[model samples]
Target: HATHCPKPFYSSMKTQLVSAIHLQEVELDDIEGGNDPADDKKDPTYTVEEAVETIGFGRFHVLLFVIMGSANIVEAMEIMLLAVVSPEIRCEWRLEDWQVALVSTMVFLGFMLCGALSGYVADRYGRWKVVVAGFFWSAYFSFLTSYAPSYGWFIFLRSLVGCGVAGVSQGFVLKTEFIPARHRAYLLPLATIFWMLGSMLIIVLGMTVVPTYGWRWMIRLSVTPSVVLLFLFWFIPESARYNVSAGNTRAAMETLEWIARMNHATMPPGRLVESAQTERGSWRILLSPAFRRTSLLLWYTWFVASFSYYGSVLSSSELLEKNLLCITDADAEHRVKHRHEEGSVCYCIPFAFSDYQTLLISCLGEVALVPLNICLLNVVGRKLSLALLQFLSAIFFLLVNICTTMLGFTVLLFLLRALVSMNFNVVYIYTAEVYPTVARSLGMGFCTSFSRIGGMIAPFIAQVLMSRSVMYAMCPFAVASIVCALGNFLLPIETKGRALLVRLCPR
Candidate 1:
C-alpha cells in the first residue's frame, strides 16, 4: 500500500511525523521547566456571588420581582380575607366573639406549625420545589374553603391554606438570593406594593363581590392570583447560590448562564467554583455562638412585627364598625350603656360600603410609604430603619386610643399601617441578607414561624378585645411595638452593603 501511494502523500506523512516529534520535544521541555498543560487549558474560576454580582440587576430580576411579588400578593389576600370575611362568618354561624376570633387564630396556628418545616424542606430539597408546591397546596385548599358547609370545615381548610402560605415565603428567599446587594434596598421595599395591592383587592372584593355574590364567591375569586402564579412558576429558576451551596456546580452554572442571557449581560469568564456543602437545614447553626444573639433578637422582632401589624389590620374593621353603628347619638349612648350586658343581641353585619372604602384607603398607606422606606433602607440602613419604623408604629397605636373623632382615628390607622408595613419590609430584607445561603430559607422559616405566633394571638386582641374596649386592643400592640424597636436597635449585625455568607465556617 505504501509503494502504491502518491509521492505527495508520502511527503505529507513524513512532514506530519517530523512536526509531531518536534511538538513532543517542546511539550517535554515545558514539562521539565515546571509548566503544566492542564493549567494552560484551565480557565479562571469565579464564586457564585461574584458571578451574580457581575450579572447585576436587570430584566431577569424585574421578572423575578413580579413573579415573587405576586406570591406575596396571594399571601396578603389570604390573610386579609380573614378580616374581611370574619364578620360574615360570625353572622352566619351565630358564633361568639371568641369563636370568630378563633377562625383567624387557626390560620396562623397552621402557619406557625408548618413555617419552619417548610423552610427545612426548602433548604434540604430545593426552594423552587417548595414554592411551586406551596402555590398548588394553597390554591387547592383555598378553593375548597369556598365550599365549606360549616364553621368547622371552614376553619380547618383555612388553616391548611395558611400552611401553604407558609411555604410560599420561600419564593421571597429565592428572589433575595438572586438580587444584587446594591439593588436589594430599592427592590425589596418596592415589592410591598404587590402586598398592598392584594390587601386593597380583597377589600374591593369585599365591597363589590361580597355585597352582590356573598363571601363564598369572594373567596373563590381570591384564589385567582394563586392560580396565575402557578402559570408563571415555569419561568422561575432555582437559586444559583443555592445550587452552588448544595454542590451542584453544573446546575448553578447553567442557571447563571441563563440569568446572564436574560439580563443582556455576560457571565464571569470562568467555571463556577462550588462552595463547600454544609448542613442544609441545621437549627443549631442559627443558635450557634455566631448567630445566636442576632437570631434571638430577630425572632422577637418578627413576633412584634406580625403582632402589631395584624392587630391593627384586624382591629380596623371593628373600629370602623363601631363608628358606623354609632353615627346616631341615641344608638351611641345605647351601645355604651348596654355594652357589657349578657345575652344582648349582637349586630353581626358585614362591612358596609363605606367601611370597605375606609379599608381600601388604609391599604394605600403601605404604598405611600414605599419611597420613604427605600430612603430609610439606603440611608438609615436596616437596623435603624427597622427601629425607627417600629417606634413610630408604637406611637400610632397609642394615638389610635386617644383619638376621639372618626376622621382622626382613620388618619392614625392609616399612618399606623404604613409604619408597620414598612417595618415588615425592613425586617424581611434584613433577615434575607443576614443568613448564609446554607440556611437562608430555614432561617426565614424559623423567623416567620415566630411571627405566626404573633398572628395567632392578634385576632383575639383585635376582635375579641376591641369588641369590649379600644384601649384593650391597642395597648398590647403598642407595648409589643416598643419592645421590638428596642430589639431592632440591639441587633448585632447590619447587613447593608454586605455580601451574603455562603457558609458559617470553612470546612
Candidate 2:
C-alpha cells in the first residue's frame, strides 16, 4: 500500500492506521476493566424460580397477600356459615338430625366433586380466570341460598356454592407461585389469620344479625366479601410461573416487569428461560413413582386435618349446649326433653349471644398459634412441624373427654382448634411447596378434594353423634389426628428453604 506513494494515498493510509490503533486501545481498556461490548448487546436470562427469588419480597407481595388473604376470608366465611346456619335451618324446616347433617354433607360433596376439575381448568386456562369465575359463581349461589324456600333448595344452592369455593384455592396457588421461598414459610401460615377473622366474623354476624333479622339477612351480608372480591379481581395478575409452563414467554416477561415496577426493583436484564412444557394438570405426574408416596400421604393428612377441624367447629354449639345445661341445672330436664324430641337440637335460636362469644373466643386460637407455626415451619420444617401439630391435636382431643367444667372444656377446645388450624396451615404450605408449578393447583385440588371427603363425613359425627355422646364423637377425631401424625412422619419430602419447582425433571 505504501508503494502507491501518492500524497493523498499516504494521508488516507495514515488516517486508517491511526483509527485502528485508537479502536484497539479502547478495546484493551474495556478488556482490562472486564467490560465486554458483546455482553452489553446480549440480554441476561433466568428461570421463573430465579426471577421470583431475585424479585424477593416487596410491596407487590404485600398487596397480593391482602387480596389473596381476603379470598381466604370469603371462603372461610362461606364454609363457617354452614355451621352457624345449620341449627336454624333445621329448626325452621322441621328437619331431622341426619337431614341437618345432610346440608353440610351436600356442600362438601360438591366441593369434593369440583376441586380437581377446577384445578385442571386453572392449570390449562389461567389461575386468574378460574378464581374470578369461582368468586362470581359462589356469590351468585350464596345470594340464591338466602331466598331458598325449602330445605331441598337450600342444600342444592349451598352445594353449588361449595363448588365455587373449590376453585378459590387456585388463588392460593397463584399466591404461592409469586411468593419467594423464604417468605412463604411465614406468610402462608399468616393467611390463617384471615380465615380466623372470617370464622369470627360469621359468628359475630350470627350473634347480631341472625338473632334480629334472621339467617336470611346473615346470608345476604356474608356474600359481601365475595362481591367486593369480584371488583378487585382485576388487580391480580396471572401467575408468571404458569405463563412459562404454558409456553407464554412474552406474557411471563411482562408480568415480571410489572412486578418489578410495583416492587420498585429491576428486572434481570435477560429474557425468561421458558420452562419445558408439562402435561398441564396431569394426575399421572402426581402418582408417578417419584411423587406417589408423598401424594398419598398428603391426601390423608389433608383428610384428617379437615375432619378434625370441621368436627370441632360443627360440634361447638352442641358442646356449649351441654355445658350450659350442666351450668343451669334448672332447665336441664326441659332442654333434655326438647333435644330428645327434636333429635339433637343444639339451639332453639341458631346461636345464643353467649354461645357466639364462646365460639369467637375459640376462633382466637387460630390467630394465636400462627407465630408458633411459623417458627416451626422455619426451624423443624414442614414435615416435622406438621407431625408435631397433629400429635398435639390428638392429645387435645383426648383431653376434651376429661373436661368437667365449661372453663376446662373451653380451654381444651381452644387448644384443639389451634392445633388443627396449624395442622391445616402446614398442610397448605407443604402441599403448595411440594408440587411443581405445572401441577400445583391440580395437586392442591386433589388434596383438597380428599379433605372434603372428611368434611362430608364430619357433620354426621359433629352434628348427630356429638349431640348424643361427646366421647363418641371426639374419639374419631383423636384417632384420625393420630393417624395423620404418623402419616406426616412418613412424608418423603421436606420443602423448607427449597425453591419451588417450575417443572419436574424428565426421567
Candidate 3:
C-alpha cells in the first residue's frame, strides 16, 4: 500500500504523527488521478473544533470544574440566604406579609434585569471578566444588605445582590467550552453537588449562627468567599472557542497551546484550526427559525423548573411551620413536665424551630438527590430525566394535599423538593449543551431570566394560594410541571454525546 502511494505522502514520517488528516472518497480519486505534490507538502489546515477536540479532557478541565462549581456554591448560598433571613427581617421591621414577598420577588426581578446582560457581555467580551465582576458584585451587595437600616434599603440591596449573582449562570458556558463532548453529560450533573453543599451550608449556618450573631452576621460572613473567588478568577483562562468565534485567531492559538501544555496533550505543528466569523450574534437570532422552537421550549422549561424549585424551598419554611411547631411543642411539653421547669427551650424563639428545621431538611433533600440525578442523566439522557423528575414532583405535590399525618406531609414535601432539585440539575446541563458557542451564554441567560419570572411569581403563589389550601397553593406548579414535561418532548435536539458547535449562525 505504501509503495502504491505518491512519494510526498511517505517523504516525512513526522508530519503523519502530527496530523490527523484522512483521505475522503473525493480526495482518493484525486490522489489516484494525479494530485499536486506541493499542495500535499504544504500541510493541512484544521478548524478550532478539530484542534480543541484533539486536546481531550485533562488538567484545564479540572480547574474549570473547581472554579465553576464554586460559583454554583456561591449562587446557592446567596439564594437561600434571602429565605432564611426574610423572617428575621419581618420580625425586626414589623413588615407585612406582602412586604416580605416583595423582598423575595425583587431579587429575581434583579436577575431578570441583568441575566441577559451577563450572557451577552460574556459572549461579547469574555466569560472570566463577567464572572469576576459577578463575584465582587454579589459580595459587595450581600455585605451591604447585612447593614440595611430600613426595609426599603434592604430590598434595594438584595436586588443588587441578585444582579451580581446572575454572573454564576455564566459558569455553564465557561465550563462547557472546555469539556469534551463525550464527558459533557456525565460531568455537568456532578456540579450540582456543590449546589447541594451550598444549600446544606446555609441551613447549618442558619441553625447555628442566626440564633447567636443574627441573620445580618450570617449574610456578612457569607460574603467573605467572594473576595477569595475574585482573586482566584484572575488565574482562570478565557474560552478558546470564544476566541475563535470572535475571530481572535492569535489569542485562540495561544489558549490552545496553553491547554495542550497543561493537559500534557500534543498540539499540531501547523496553524491551529478555527472557524472564523466576521460579525457577532444578536439576541434577535434566538427568534430565528433554526433556534425558535428550542428557545421557546427552553424558556418554558426554565420557568417551571425555577417556579417549582424556589416555591418548594422558600415556602417550606412557612408552609410547614405549623407541623414543625407541633413537634417542638411536644418535646418542650415533655421536658417541662419531667424537669418541672418553665419549658426550657431548644431555640431562642418558636419561629426559629419552624424556620430553621424545615430549611435544614429541605436542603438535605437536595443533597440526597444528587447521586440519583447523576445516574438518571447518564442512563436516560436529558429529556426523560427532566420529564420523569417533573412528573414525580407533581405527584408529590398532589400527595402533600392529601396526607393526614404530619410525618406524611413532611415526607412528601421532601420528595417534592428532591425532585425539583434534580430537575434543576438536568435543565442546567441540557441548556448548556443545546446551543452553539456563539449564542450559548445568551441562550442560557435568556432562559434563566425567564425562570426568574417564575421565581418572581412563586412568592405570590405561596403567599396567596397556600392560605386557601395546600392543593390550591400547589396547582400552578403542578400545571407548570406538566407543561414542562410536554415541552421536553418537543425539544428539537438531543444533545447527549454531541459535539459543542463553534458557531450556529447561517452561512
Candidate 4:
C-alpha cells in the first residue's frame, strides 16, 4: 500500500529548519508567529536564551547585579584610566601627547592579540577559572603600575595589563551567561556602571589627588577595588552554561537545579544540552564564511570604538586645555601639587606641562551617557545604537577642524562623546547576546582580543592625527563605523528569547 521515499522526512526537516530561521532573526519578526512559547519548551534540552530567562529573577539576583556592576566599573577603570590621566601622565614623563597615549592603547592592542588565546583557555578549562585568574592577575598589575621604572617599562607593563583585560571578557561571559534573558539589556548596562564608576574614580582622583600626589598614586588606586573584590568573588558559581557546553550533563543539570532553587522555581524536569560537541572551537571554525563576516565586523567595530573611546578620553582638549591655562599660574598649580602630595609617597614632577584636554568633557560625557545608552540599546537595536554613535563621533571630530567656536566645538565635542560612551556598554551586551552558550565566552574573548588592535591603534592614531591632522587616520574609524552598520544586516541573529538549543541555521 505505502511505498514511500524518505524525501518527506528530509523535506519536513528542511521546512522546519527554514521556519526556525525566520523565528530567530534578531532584527525583525524576532519572536516569530507567537509560537506557543511553553509548548515548544522542553526540560533538558532548554536553549541558552531560555536558561538566561531564569537568571535575574532568582535569589541572588541583587548580588549578581552588584557584582556584575562593580566588575564593569573595575574593568572600565582599567581600560580608560590611562586615557583619563593622559595629560597629567604626559607632563610627568615629558612625553609627547601621543607617546603617553600609547601606554593605554597598547594594552588594548595586547588585549586584541590575546582574545583567541583567552577563549581557547576558557574552553579548555572553565569560565570561572579564567574569570578568577583574570581578576587576581589584574589586581597585582595595578600595584605594579605604581612603580613603573621608565616610559619603556610603563608601555611593557601596560601590555601586560592588557593580558588581564582579555581575562575580564571571559569573566563577563560567565557573569553575563548566568543572567536572566529578559533582564539582560538592563542588567548588563547596569553592571557596566563600572566604566563610568571607573571614570568617576579617576575623575575624583584627578580633581583631588593626582595633581598633588602623582600619577603613580592614581594608578595604585585603580586596582584597589578589584583587590578587595578578590575576596568578594568567593560565592559566585561556575557557569552552568559552560558546564553544559563541556558535555557534563550531570554537572550541568546540577547547576541549573541549584539556580532553580536560588530562583525559588521548581527543579526543572529535563536535560540541558549545553553544546553538541562539534569542533566548534578552533581557528579553523572561526575562518568559515559565517564567522569571517562577523569577525570582520567585530574587528572593525572593536577598533573604531576603541579609537573613538580612547581618542576622546586621551587626546581631547578638555583637560589639557585647562592645564595649559593653569601653567601660567605656577604657584596655584604648585600649591595644588603640594596639597595633593601632602604626606604622599612619591614626588615625580613634571618639568613643564603640555597642552591637553581636561576630562571635563569626558565627565560631561559620563554624566549623560548611561540613560541615553539605555534608551538606544533597549529601543533601538545594538547595531544601530553603536553605528549611529560612531558615525556621529567621527563627524564631530572632523567638524572640530572646520568650526572654530569654543562654544560650538565644545558642544560638538560633548555631543561626540555622548555618542562614544555608548560603545563599550552596548558592545559587551551585544556581543554576549549574539553568541550561543557553547562558544559564548570564547567568542567574546576572541572578539575583545581583536579589539585590542583598535585599542593599540587608538593611541597611535590619536597621536598622529593630533600631530598631523590628516583626515585619513581618524576618518577610517568613521568609515569603519559605517561598514559595521551595514554588516549587521548580514550577520544579525538574536538569541534574546530563544532556547539554548533552538533550531536555527548559521547562514
Per-candidate TM-scores read: 0.90, 0.89, 0.85, 0.77
- Which residue pairs come into collision in candidate 1? none
lDDT of 1 by residue, 409-471 (tens): 567778989999999989999999998888899999999999999999998998888877877
lDDT of 4: 0.64
Per-residue C-alpha lDDT of model 4 across residues 99-175, encoded as one tens digit per residue? 76667766876677777788878866788788778878777877797798888888888787778767866777777
Please identify model 3 stretches exceeding 4 Å from their true place: 1-42, 322-358, 404-407, 505-507
Tens-place lDDT per residue, model 3, 252-305, is 888888888999998865666566654445687687787899899999999999
User: Which ranking of candidates, highest lDDT first?
Assistant: 1, 2, 3, 4
Which 10 consecutive positions of candidate 1 have the poorest summed lDDT?
Answer: 325-334
Poorest 10 consecutive residues by lDDT, candidate 2: 325-334
| Model 2 stretches with alpha carbons more than 4 Å out | 1-43, 321-349
- Candidate 2 whole-model C-alpha lDDT, 0 to 1: 0.85
Per-residue alpha-carbon lDDT of model 2 for 225-268, expressed as tens digits? 89898988798899998898899989989999899889988876
lDDT of each: 0.86, 0.85, 0.77, 0.64
| Poorest 10 consecutive residues by lDDT, candidate 4 | 318-327
Clashes of each: 0, 1, 5, 29
CA displacement after TM-score superposition, residue 281 of candidate 3 (Å): 3.8
